[model samples]
Target: MNSFFSQPTLQLAQSLIGMELVHESKEGITSGIIVETEAYMGPEDRAAHSYGGRRTKRTEVMFDQPGSIYMYFIYGMHVCFNIVSGPPGKPEAVLIRALEPVSGIALMEKRRYSSWKRSPAQARKIMHLTSGPGKLCQAMGLGLELYGSKMNKGPVFLKENKKIPASMIEAGPRINVHYAGEAAEYPWRFWLRGSPYVSKS
Candidate 1:
């Protein structure tokens, strides 16, 4: 298993700048170039820890060994997945926000179709296929079952790609974090510039 993913939170966040998110499902192994991500660092990060350092059964996995998966349900529906980083006892993770469809586009299209009732063309146009956090997880077939799973040696993991130039990368505040107060202002979100796959510009 590659240790790059097991590094510190900030390192993983920056190293993942140019990588691919490969998803293997019954449909096939669909891959996408990672275009956007956000880092949530431990209890101190007000944007993280719903209980603010209070660990519950749901968040217990976050305190597990690094490289574990931390998946949670939101909006009573969607599953958002994150890869835990940093040392044990220090909860930190990188959120995969957007992906540019690279391989197995057809499979992605089909999986996305099953989730939302949209025509192929409309799915490709209006839906963004693998854009939003929830949409990305849906298209990748990720859920609680994948929580605490290791991605480095599993069916899903990050793979290296050609280095994206600095000019092509941009940073901004995370989305839908109004409740985080000052933490919402943190510019932890990073994305590829001019990438159509980005959920938001």
Candidate 2:
């Protein structure tokens, strides 16, 4: 399982598909098969937070060893989870974009909607329970508190689920990265082909 992170960032992003990302908490255990991911290569990729080798307190974890968790806050309200895919000093990561929930659906739905009123207009469906980055974190109980932690440590970790055929995977431009200029066109985002849980970009 540890050797899995040794792959290149682009490969890691695609390889993550079909693997089960699990989080065990007091609430219960919630797990999902990774269906979509986006790779961010730093220093050169303008879409990356570590572009030009910029390292601040928020991005410090990106420089850590491979498999280190590099979670961050986004839009001042949502938490996004990234897995460091590094060669020790390099700042590259794979953002977990979406997941297909396979365990604790009831709990996930509860965690996802219990916090606020379920607006009828939202039309929240089980397929959308963990369809996006922020939604997955909220459903799985992931937060900034787990920042910088190793993937195999604590209550959250990945379990090998099944192997995804290469033909069943596809790549495209990352979502919400138009500000990256030319980098926005890079086909760094990977997803399971025909997966309904993939984020709608």
lDDT, candidates in the order shown: 0.78, 0.92
lDDT of 1 by residue, 86-124 (tens): 777777888888888788877766677865655545525
**Highest TM-score model number:** 2
**What would the TM-score be for candidate 2 when compared with the true structure?**
0.96
Off by over 4 Å in 2: 118-123
lDDT of 2 by residue, 1-201 (tens): 777897999999988999999999999999999999999998899999999999999989999989999889999899999999979889999999999999999999889887765565575788889999999999999989999999887888899887999999999999999999999999999999999999985
Candidate 1 residue pairs in clash (backbone atoms < 3 Å):
none
Scanning candidate 2 in windows of ten residues, the lowest lDDT window is 115-124
In terms of lDDT, the best-performing candidate is: 2
**What lDDT, from 0 to 1, does candidate 2 have?**
0.92
The list of candidate 1 runs beyond 4 A from truth reads 118-123
Q: Residue 140 error for model 1, in Å?
A: 1.4
